[model samples]
Target: EKAEALGVPAGPERSRLVRGESVTLADGRIVHPDDVLGEPVPGAKLVYVGDASRVDDLVEEARGADVLVVEATYLEAEADLARKYGHLTAAQAATLAREAQVRQLYLTHISRRYSEREVLAEAEPIFPHTVVAKDFDRVRVVKQQ
Candidate 1:
């Protein structure tokens, strides 16, 4: 029953991802990702992180996500520096969020050089739903209809 509550199938192989199969929770919620098995719980709050850089690969995985928390390690003016360190700039992170169609984007792991205002200014135009995460910031993720 514990497995069932978490939406994992019962038996030795408690959980496995099979294409086209969705795990149904006890409360009738369904969990499924666009690709791959063992992805985060669906129909619940989902947070996808691009880590330092190379967020390009996360586009598909992040589609329809509630919140995409990616690194915005530098301002757009320092794009070259960001690339050299394998990190993303504010604008790049915003663009990724737009392409993925995520509901909201929270930019984190920022470099010390940039102020929160600078980061927000760079990202807001490209993706209006973007926000720069600060210490102890509380954000609520709501599921879209």
Candidate 2:
């Protein structure tokens, strides 16, 4: 669980460095901070939003993400219920994807009341890249050149 155990130097300033950027340590050792960061591949912004009822608050964080994984726990017909339970509807999830301009969107945490088809139907029209996530489904988000 230590960053150094994973070959990444642990420190407060590590996150602020970008790819190919380097910093010199007090002990005279040089470190390329980005080399130890997550997402070894370049040109992709990956985001995951869970248990979020409101997407409006996440607009800035989700902007221009290559892939966004979010929750759609209710159908549009159950908007009131979704709000009460602090969960997003399929439509709302799609709206968030559209607003964020994410290249791909995967919807998860669906309520048992709706089928996978129903969730996809509600989201696809709003955001063409939307998909319903099933158990153990693996999705790859490749950055477009």
> TM-score of every model?
0.68, 0.71
Best by lDDT: 2
Q: Which lDDT tens digits does candidate 1 get at residues 1-145? A: 4444455656423444344555655568665533334555557346556545567677888887888888899898888888888889899889889998988889999989888989999999999998888889998777876
Instruction: Give the total clashing residue pairs for model 1.
Output: 0
Q: State residue 2's C-alpha deviation in candidate 1, in Å.
A: 18
Q: Which stretches of candidate 2 lie over 4 Å from their true place?
A: 1-42
Per-residue C-alpha lDDT of model 2 across residues 62-106, encoded as one tens digit per residue: 999999999999998988988998989999989999998989999
lDDT of 1: 0.77
Residue pairs clashing, model 1: none
The per-residue C-alpha lDDT of model 1 at residue 77 equals 89
